[model samples]
Target: MKAADLFEFPASIPFADFFRADALPWQWIGQIKKALASGFETNVPGSIPPGVRISGEVYIHPSVELPAFCSIEGPAWIGEGAQIRPGAYIRGNVIIGAGSVVGNSCEYKNCLLLEDVQTPHFSYIGDSVLGNGSHLGAGVILSNLRLDQKPVKALVDGKSVDTGLRKFGALVGDQAEVGCNAVLNPGSILGKRSLVGPLTPFKGTLGPNKLLVSKPETSIQER
Candidate 1:
């Protein structure tokens, strides 16, 4: 339940080697081993143009943007100007930062999406982290378990934080702004410049410049 009360540090975004809370009650396999030591990568696509089927220890970048029956699988990393628009479905230790924007039928696993984040259309981010320039509007769905699924804890600033994992999701911070169809449940923590409106259904923390507009009308102001 630590990690400095489930992440808040970002005064200037230099998370050194990325992360390292010394395993203070994290789960999802220590957040996928601190997102594989925070140097996560995976944006494949080196020929397979016939129909598309990238899977060779992915790490694609150079103006990334794949569509056609998308099926990326590997130590995933599609950063630099990311934009996997069509039938998007990324798997494996994901990252997808940079210009981030995974639209159409979006679906990610072991997520991170930092840089200019944006789950464009139908979102389904897993084991989350979506921070930098955040923006998940259309159908934003990020509930990583815990109806009785146990092991999902994070209620920082008021205590109760214990993300020993059972598939923890939602920790959205940075330039947060989730609206349309928003439903970040689990360990939801939209801080820095927060604001969740349309169809909201958030959970735990919503502090820094908060403005969650739904369940009980939150509006902690700051920005």
Candidate 2:
């Protein structure tokens, strides 16, 4: 694999850098598409039945389970063994990865949820990237669009990176855990294995294995 394909992220780039208004222009949906395509063919191959209702172009892998109450809009991919519980709303251009769980009352739009990700309660995720093994606690929410309704951008290493999209949410790295009722603002990021305490409003970049109790008050500790 190409180095660009391996890490798929810029080198030494701060997580907060992904939100700067002047960050480099990156095609996030394209990256997600590439990632899904690189893996298996089905959205939830070997799990979901072909007769399930998929509105629009979608890819599902084997072993995916979609209950009748699940609504799926396409340009979306559901990976192997992923479960879409009842009352889940999955909008277009989202990638739900292998073994992930999208629980009841959860809504996802234009996001990338990597392998083993779980959002097990009332959650709203939009234009976000949830890394492998990440989990969002109950009532967690991510705000992708600014209230002013301007385009979203990313900051990388102090440089501005444009996302070229009007809506974009948080980017949670591998194994991150967001606590219940927490809010991840637009362009926020949680580095690998980071933890966010309940009711926290995360507005900036959180480093790898960081423990975030609230905004600007986070610690780095071993799990």
lDDT of 2 at 59: 72
Which stretches of candidate 2 lie above 4 Å from their native place? 1-30, 33-53, 153-164, 215-223
Against the true structure, what is each candidate's TM-score? Answer: 0.32, 0.75
Clashing pairs in 1: 41-76, 42-76, 42-77, 43-59, 43-60, 43-77
For model 1, the superposed segments whose C-alpha errors exceed 4 Å read: 1-17, 22-43, 48-65, 68-83, 87-94, 97-101, 104-111, 114-128, 131-135, 139-177, 181-195, 199-211, 214-223
Please write out the lDDT profile of model 2 over residues 1-223, one tens digit for every residue.
1112212342211222232323222345335545434443333334554444567667766466567667788768776678888888888767777788988989988777767888999999987777777899999999887798887766555655666777778878778899999998877767677898999887766667778785466555666
- Candidate 1 lands at a TM-score of 0.32
